[model samples]
Target: MKKQFNRMRQLASQTVGRAEKTEVLSDDLLQIERRMELVRLVSHNTHKRLVSCLQGQVGTDSEKRHKKLPLLALCQTMQDGGAQLGDESLIGKMMEVCGQAETTLASELMEHELQIERDILEPLYQLAEVDIPNILKQRKQLSKLVLDYDSARTRWYQATKSSNQAMAAKVDSLKDEMEEALNKVEICKDQLSADMYNFSSKDSDYASYYLTLLESQADYHRKSLAALETAIPNIQLQQGQMGGPTTPPPPITPLNSPARELTSTPPPQRNGSVYLTAGTPHSQGGSRGPSPHLMRRGRSSLHVPLKGDPRGRPRIRWEDDISKLALGRLGIPQDEVSSLLELFPSRPDS
Candidate 1:
């Protein structure tokens, strides 16, 4: 209880002395403390905001099975939707490539955020929560000790000036207390000054950490830009096709159309031969060839009676392919092909 009262008294005295501008804090130390306090406040808030951004940009593990950036999630959704639309769809193809680019961007962004957390946010947090706070606590302890030393000195001086000799022992004890308090104040002041100088020395390092963050941010934007630049032209090309003309399909012909009959008519026969004249035979008449009755039959017209064999006896011979010659002349139906063959006897060579 006595210790608590003394602590309260010392705090009150220190507060009054500081307010009256009589506490006499070192100018450099005061400036360092003030700057450290600001750093702690700003950095702590920055850390909080960065963490919040991470949670929002990339969902927490509990919120998402595989913590994905918001854009990554969107890209995945687009990719799946594109696949569902099938390979031939133009929009589907564009979505496929766009989603791939966005996926790459999302991955890069996630990497950047993680790097920031590691290099910037984590260090800021340490400065705010640990390093600066420890230094400030030491400053506060030093302030209290200074107040205690002052109080001890005042008491010792009063005891020495006492008109009563009976107070000599009390004076000696008070002087001892004053000396011990001064020793503590000197020690704490030395430690606080050292910490302030150390903090000041690290100022450049803090600045460079922010520069590193900027570099990371610039690299991230470059990647994102490259991805978008590649995607935009393809998307534009697809967009341009929206109103262009399409080729019409070829005309379809009916299976039994007259046009087919016209096409089926044999082109005028050449040199009195049908498909081939290699083994064709001719009769004695040469030009007159087969009789009119046989000539009337398109299949028989294919036969040319040539001069007889060396023996001079007349012979009949037709093209090796009887069906081809008949069918090639008239558009003979497939079902009548067998009947036409029976009309022309098989060659003896068969």
Candidate 2:
């Protein structure tokens, strides 16, 4: 009975030891699973953050630089009239920002992924050392974990590829937009230059025309003043001659008197014409009337002067004689001179 009791106690002690060792193994497995879960949560959070950053929710150096680049370029364009702005500066800044963000995110993701892998491997090693059955069961779980990890890794890789592709596309789009804007600016500059040139040309033409008009007006006024100056002296001389007074005349001489010859003879009444008496031997007949030839001759010799020449002013001669003038000057032939003179009478000056 004593041997059997001792055997039973030893058996219970062995069973208790076995239970304790199993409990310890279970605890270690649970710890390892908890650690793996923690690692998964940490990795997931990091991946979520990285995705958010890639999706533009979390700002990175690339995002900040992209946001600031347009504003900086706009300010520069405004300040310098678009002349000093360039695409090189903007593109360089964009590349720098993308590189920085990529490096930082890649480093962080790799570190977290490595840590999770190490943690999962540690549990796998411990399970191998313990119960072979537990290790086998955990191997199945580990295979699932590996699949999940592979899925996560694939997602990360796909996300990285998509992010890089999106970034490249965005950069290309921005470059195209910038190039179009620059072309518009250049067109505006050319238009402004053309307008300025036209305005300057018009102003110069107007100035020249105005100066020409002024010179023409000045010349006209100068000619008018000269004509007035020449006419002033002639007007003054005419005024002086008209301002003088009139004069009286003298009486006739005694030898030219008519009353002394009529006392020696009685006058006889003849026909209507007057007849002069002749002395004794010189006269053919005292009763004969005046000769008809003498009367005709006296009538033909009578001359009448022009009405304005009552005081008998001397005639003013022209430089050339009208009768002896050439046909070209007189505008008529010598044979036709009488008819031309009848049509247009010759003036005393001509």
Estimate candidate 1's alpha-carbon lDDT, on a 0 to 1 scale: 0.68
What candidate 2 gets wrong by more than 4 Å, as runs, is 1-173, 195-214, 230-234, 241-350
Of the candidates shown, which would achieve the greatest lDDT relative to the real structure?
1
**What tens digits encode model 2's per-residue C-alpha lDDT throughout 222-340?**
65455546555554454345452224355564555566566545454232122112223335544443344544442233221233544543333311233244344434445454332
Q: Per-prediction count of colliding residue pairs?
A: 6, 0
C-alpha TM-scores of all predictions:
0.58, 0.18
Candidate 1 lDDT, 1-350, residue by residue in tens: 65456556656766676322125368877888899989889888877877786633433333352255678788998899889986578778767877887877777777677677778887887888999999999988887777677777766776888887777669988889889988998888888899889999999987777788788889878988887898777766765575423455666676666788878876653332332222225666344334434534544354533333343223323333444655575544434544443444333331
Range of the 10 consecutive residues with the lowest summed lDDT in candidate 2: 271-280
Model 1 deviation from native, Cα RMSD in Å: 23.6
Cα deviation in Å at residue 287, candidate 2? 99
